[model samples]
Target chain A: MYMVAFLGPNASYTHQAARDRFNQDTCVLSPQVTIEDVFQQVQSRVAKFGVVPFENSTNGSVVFTLDLFADIKSRHPDIVVCGEAYVDVHHCLLGRGAARLTDTSLSSKTDSPTSSGQATPTSKVPYPKTPAVKPVVPVKHVKKLYSHPQAWGQCRDFLSTYLKGVERQDVSSTSRAAELVAEDQSGSSAAISSAIAAEVHGLDVLARNIEDSADNKTRFFILKRTDCLEHQPMHRGAKVVDDDQNSFKSLVSFTVNHEDPGSLADSLAVFKSYKLNLTSINTRPSGLVPWNYIFFIEFKGRRENDGATGAVNAALRDLNNVAKCWRWLGSWESEL
Target chain B: MYMVAFLGPNASYTHQAARDRFNQDTCVLSPQVTIEDVFQQVQSRVAKFGVVPFENSTNGSVVFTLDLFADIKSRHPDIVVCGEAYVDVHHCLLGRGAARLTDTSLSSKTDSPTSSGQATPTSKVPYPKTPAVKPVVPVKHVKKLYSHPQAWGQCRDFLSTYLKGVERQDVSSTSRAAELVAEDQSGSSAAISSAIAAEVHGLDVLARNIEDSADNKTRFFILKRTDCLEHQPMHRGAKVVDDDQNSFKSLVSFTVNHEDPGSLADSLAVFKSYKLNLTSINTRPSGLVPWNYIFFIEFKGRRENDGATGAVNAALRDLNNVAKCWRWLGSWESEL
Candidate 1:
């Protein structure tokens, strides 16, 4: 049996990604509380493979995932991301079988998240209070919306157009939101969850595909211990490898030296001169230093490819001149 | 008098930073609930200036600060960061005057936050419970610990060495954490908060400067509306500009072309060729595209300086060849 770990609860997006990437029949999957746990479990050999969210089309990058790379590189250098999976995120408003919520219950905490994330500005002298929190007047129809905080951004249009002023209560997950509504047995409250979660929690689907944009998709990375990948223990590993033929892609994470200007440009020139097609480029805090950044770049072709091999060699050589540190995260075929 | 906004409460790190940056006699400061609100309030002219946390010496960058620049560039193109201040973060373990929490109250929700932020992970098939939540062998000494989530990282050694396995509860702010402990009135419960907060909330400091590092410092950015800066409505504007002694620094936020491997490198080359000293570099998701990044670079010298002016022009021109978008945030003297 193969053991895999992903950001969990059985009905989460990560779970869906894991099921899509790995066959459930032979895989024993575990859910980790945090992305760090997912990485830790894989590093500690508690699970052969780990699955974590990389980015969401609507909500944007899963920053902690990028931040964890610094920790992982320092502690667990033997692990690497070897595969990927994508899931179309469709949000459904799920509620209890009951019809309406009590007026008092509907009026949830009126305070909206005003702070961007960290510090809020304050004054010793009370100036004219700025119209900050839009006194969220509870809508008569939908009084409370229970969903993941990230869901609020995705269902913006639906919430404003249909259920304006509905108080949003952020929960652990969409599934948890469904559980909360189910447990509360409140008709007035609704949760934006997955259809699978609605069914699992025995909730009525109030609305389906309520996301503002249809292109909402989340990408997941399948990671494995470097040693496990080389030995190829499981039959599934070979199957996954066989799916992608001679064509493959690689991830290069590097930090450019701030002291040297154009150093990063020259390094990129190596890839340009070699005619490598880059699919994506992202930056994460090096975490080693306060403001320095580490760039994560995904490009077409495998390191083993003749042309790609030459580019990798030249880029590595040139990058040494411009980069403070660099690493080859992994080379894997895009299963997209 | 100039109106400024900062992160809430009278003694929060942001509040302290604001008081340090702006003259209290001439400035009326308003506390915003979130860092985002501070930016939004300043952009909308609700406040003439805003102060928000930029980075923590030990913890790392205030990522949303970088993320807000993306939103500000889109919504309020006229606002710019004008100044900065640094505040030393000193954490104290505070408790109620009543003293001593019951072992029961201390163990009240034994579930530790497994999720990094606010989410929890669950499994489809509940495996044999892996002794997840440690049965807190609640010692009569200390019942529980309450503090901001960030505190857990900073006081790692202290917690592991002294409060090993003591139940930890993550609150909104360290000050809020103190408030909670004070409200609990349980002598057993403790909060890691600022010394000022402990006094404000009427809590006793059980432990002072519990942070693992001695030099824990948080930097704050002072922002102002573009018109306010140019018009010099307040006497302070000229004073701020004059203090810089004709030497100022500028911030440029840009997104490199993914199609061009060396595009970012080339832009940096412009800075190098012009002999401009780059102060700091950070990157955040553009949000316009998933996983793609917009780079924020800080360099010494104002836009008017020949070397700085030439670098900005050359970088913009070269960047246009290989960038999707580019923006100049603002320039000011290094307050340090």
Candidate 2:
């Protein structure tokens, strides 16, 4: 079986996307500690494909992924984005299944105000509710909350209303948080994680879809080494159905002379001439100097025929002449 | 005194930039918990000015700051980027001054490999060589290394070479990491933080400039309320010297119909027509849908007069006509 690496211990949003994008039967899912690790795994040929979070609908670009792409020309030249998968990020509040808990619905919305005049709940006592039904922990009963730091901001509305004054701790990932909460002997600890994470760690889902935004989603890129593209079996979930499907999108990174007027516009104009519809544009620090940026442009286009100078090839050829330096990240089958 | 809010407890990189950009005697420094807190303070008029990290040479853009700018139109419409400051990020390994420590220089470079074949150090005993020297904790004795998540990547070389196998803990900020190490009763804990953070938290610097990159720098934006720009006294460090100095750069955010080909190119053409040199371009998720982006363009230009259709004003007018929607983020004097 081919190894498919993803950012995970287990049950992260990236893991979800990876599972959704690749066939588990033919590809063994390997969990990596970091996004860089995933790239390193693919670069070393330890994994046939690697998945990393690219962007979030609410949080914006994942800088780690963008920075890695920025250094693609020098560091991981053989690596290319092959496909993409998106996972709707629905955060869940998780706790020990056996813990005594209070129903948040039974608690009053307006708790007693602290000296600071904010509604700070001072009580940690679990108000027993539906004891005959099942033992579940209340958010108010939890003395501490654990999750990835990003989760706190995403679940601000749910947190402030339910668990005011609770100590929020940052873990390596949301899955790790659930794992920690599961290992905790004290019932007072809980975590903001995914429902799948709760299941993997054998914890109970205290709340579902606790994120502030309804449409929170994270996009992940499926990456593979360019030289190993051939002799690779198509994963069942991959969208590469045909060569002429007109469903391909290309990503190109380039730098322009900052001192030249309209240099950026001139580079972008090449896309117009090629009739490639522009979908997205982004920039990242070049790391060589302050204020220097590497611009990445994504557009609807066809993959270049090998040595044939196709439409994308023609555009990139023109772009290379216009840009100070350029690198084609990849042309992948667009999911949507 | 004008209140200047920054992302800080005391000595984060943002706090250092805030201090460097504003006169200490004329401005009262107020530390905020998060970047959003700094923006909220400025928007509520609690602070006249706010400082937040925009991008880092190593880490790319700070998504927290970018996401805030994405919603500037509806959330903080009055906030504007008035100035910018750059901070040289020099990380230091800090520990309790009273702790017994060893000199890392005396330790052997080659450590024992773990069962996994990775070179993981098995010993935590402090090798005391500098008995006559200052009491500095050795990295080998550190059971835990605390810092912001970004610092780990920045100091990868240093960490792998000197402090391999040390457990890393992520805190809210580097300064907060220093504060945690200071408060830790266990002498085994150390922190990777700023030099200023060590001084403020009464921790001894175990190592200096531990970051992997020599050119690692963070850029911060100095923000102010647009309505309060008139009566605002000239900050001693601000670069708003003259209106026609050609040092001004404006940041504008806009969106175009994705179905419309060459729409982005047309919007960018307006800058070229007005003779505005484009310096940088970026995009953030519009938050409305997946794949939809809000493009931000920064260029050399002057702020528009109240009623005069200046070069920038005319260019923006044209851009607005071409774009589906647009918002002028700010015009600020460029530091570089």
For every candidate, the chain B TM-score is: 0.79, 0.85
Model 2: residues with Cα > 4 Å off, grouped in runs: A97-137, A230-246, A306-309, B97-137, B231-245, B304-307
Each model's lDDT comes to: 0.67, 0.77
Q: List-wise, what DockQ does each model earn?
A: 0.28, 0.53
What digit string (tens of lDDT, one per residue) describes model 1 on residues A134-246? 21232334568888778987775566555655677766688888888887644677788998898888877766787866767898888888777443133334554542323
Q: What C-alpha RMSD separates each model from the true structure?
A: 8.3, 6.5
DockQ-based class of model 1: acceptable
Clashing pairs in 2: none
Best-fitting candidate, scored by lDDT? 2
Candidate 2 docking band: medium
Best by TM-score: 2
Give residue A14's error in model 1 in angstroms.
0.9
lDDT, candidate 2, A30-70, per-residue tens: 99987878888888889999999988887777878888888
lDDT of 2 by residue, B114-176 (tens): 211223342321231211121133445567889899999888656765666778899888988
